[model samples]
Target: MFEKLSYLQLQQYWWFLVGTLAALFVFMTFVQGGQTLLRELGRSETQRDLLVNALGRKWELGFTSLVMFGGALFAAFPLFYSVSFGGAYFVWMAILFCFIIQAVAYEYRKKPDNFLGQRTYEIFLFINGSLGIFLVGAALATLFSGGHFVVNEMHLSRWTNPLYGLEALANPFNIAFGLMLFFLSRLLASLFFINEIDDEAIYARARKSLLRCTLMFLAAFAYVAYAIATMKGYGYDPATGAVFAKEGKYLQNLLAMPAVAGMLLAGVLGLLAGVAMTLWGGSRRGIWPAGIGVVLVVLALFLTLGYNDTAFYPSLSDPQSSLTIQNSSGSRYTLVAMSYVSLMVPFVLGYIAFVWRAMSAKRLTVEEVENDPHHY
Candidate 1:
């Protein structure tokens, strides 16, 4: 079946897979969002333990999603992986450092007499939740906003700015998207806590936090939506392989692809419905709807950037260096091999769902954390 399709088909297929993994990673960031609320939602040590353990059960999944996202990109679009990850080393390094601390914090937060102390570890989780997510959003924004890098004939890439990818911070659109993701994560986390934790105080606080985070998320999301709709996007000519800027490119993409626009609408409505259910209907199952909405929304965003002959990774330093799915993809042979490997994805997701269900079958309580020997 794989051998039957053209190379472009395979490239698009892998790009879709990469986008799906990225969407899942964004949804999983509810873990990061939950981390930021540990102090706000959990007022006591026992309550904090409940939050920590609840999140710890799923933090690794978010991290794994991130790794898989990177790996898929590296395999399917090595040029993009090298250009973005290599040229923007500082930003990527900071993100890596944040996740490293997150893993360490989760492992040793409850260890007997740890050297850094519990407060320090908690702080690490906060850093990962806020700074880590913000930077990732900014990094992804470069896909639309363009980055300061040049690619040579030999395919070598160099960063034009001294700040590396940190220059993305200068763009308000980037910051808006970053904050949007951060708050969305928080909102999802609150819904998750409401569903996963059996404590009254945590549930009440999570409900309130959901409202606040929803407002913040809406503000940031509105700004990003406006920016993307109005901004000039990099356009690629499939016939000549030329790159140029087109006004209202993203909005046009939405108009051109009604199915994707429908997805965006459905995702937004689902997200709003999830929040409303949690806020007014007192539904604990809000996380499921909200999480699925997040994945759909993110997947739609990625499709917008990659489809419509748009340059998914644009180079500000050299317009010709902009990367489209065709230019940045691996060889056809590699993609075919990877496509076969991709068949395992459904089974892997099913197994993860099974494990997640088994683990979450019982809600976390003060008693479980105090009694369980394996508690984080």
Candidate 2:
């Protein structure tokens, strides 16, 4: 069945798969968000250990999803992978460093005679939770806000700015998106803790944190969404396949793709409902709805960026260098081969879900961690 589609169809199919993985990666960032709250929610060493172990169990899942997201991009859209990862070296390097520290921290945090000490490792997790997530959001924002790079006839790319994409910090819109993700992650983390941990104190603190993070997330999300709606976005000419600037381009895309718009709406409402149920109704299951909501919202945004002849990655240095799926995709044979491989994704996800369920079958407790010989 997969053999029958046109090249463009395959490109779009892979783009959709990439977008889905990206959305799942963002959702998995609840692990990062939970990292930031370890000290705040866990007042005692035992409590802190509980939080750490709970998060450590799932941290590798987030890391795995991240690796998958990058691998998919590299395989399906090598040009974009090269242009952004190569040209924006500093930003990507910083992100990589943060994750590296995170891996080290998780591995050695509870190890005997560790050189760095537990506090230092905890600080590293904080850096990953805050700085790492923020950098990711800002980097993604450049997809819409455009990046400082030029692509040559050979499809080689060069960074125009000296900061090597660190300049994205200068744009408030990018920062806004970063802040939004940071708080959203925190909110999701709070909900997850409420569901997964059996401690009453942690639940109380998570509830309070959820309220605060929700407010902060709403503020940043509103600003970013409004800006995108009002801002001039990159457009593509279907006949000529050229990139150009169009006012209210994103807003128009939402209108043009009503189904995408509906997804966004449903996602926002789902998020709000999840928060409300947790804050008022005292529902521990808020994470389920809220997590799915985040995925949907992020997926809609990605679809808007890539579908409808939109330039998913725009080049500020050269509009003509903007990348659409058609321009940035791998050859048809590669995509077809990858599509066959993509069939394994569902089974992989199902296995992950099974493992997650088995691991989380019982709520985590201080006694359990104390009894277990090995703990993060």
Stretches > 4 Å off in candidate 2: none
Q: Quick one: best lDDT, which candidate? A: 2
Score every model by TM-score: 0.99, 0.99
Off by over 4 Å in 1: none
Q: Give all candidate RMSDs, comma-separated.
A: 0.8, 0.7
Give the clashing pairs for model 2.
Answer: none
User: What is the per-residue lDDT of model 2 for residues 268-369, given as tens digits with 9 covering 90 to 100?
Assistant: 988888899999997899998888899999999999999988999999999999999999999999999999999999999999999999999999999999
**Worst 10 contiguous positions by lDDT, candidate 2:** 233-242
Candidate 1 residue-wise lDDT, 1-376, digit = tens: 9999998899889988999999999999999999999999998988999999999999999999999999999999999999999988899999999999999999999999898999999999999999999999989888889998898878888989998888899998888989998999999999999999999988989998999999999999989999999999988898888999899989999999999899888889889989999899978999988888888898998989999898998889999999999989999999999999999999999999999999999788899889999898
Against the unseen true structure, what C-alpha lDDT does each candidate score?
Answer: 0.93, 0.94
Query: Where does candidate 1 clash, by residue pair?
Result: none
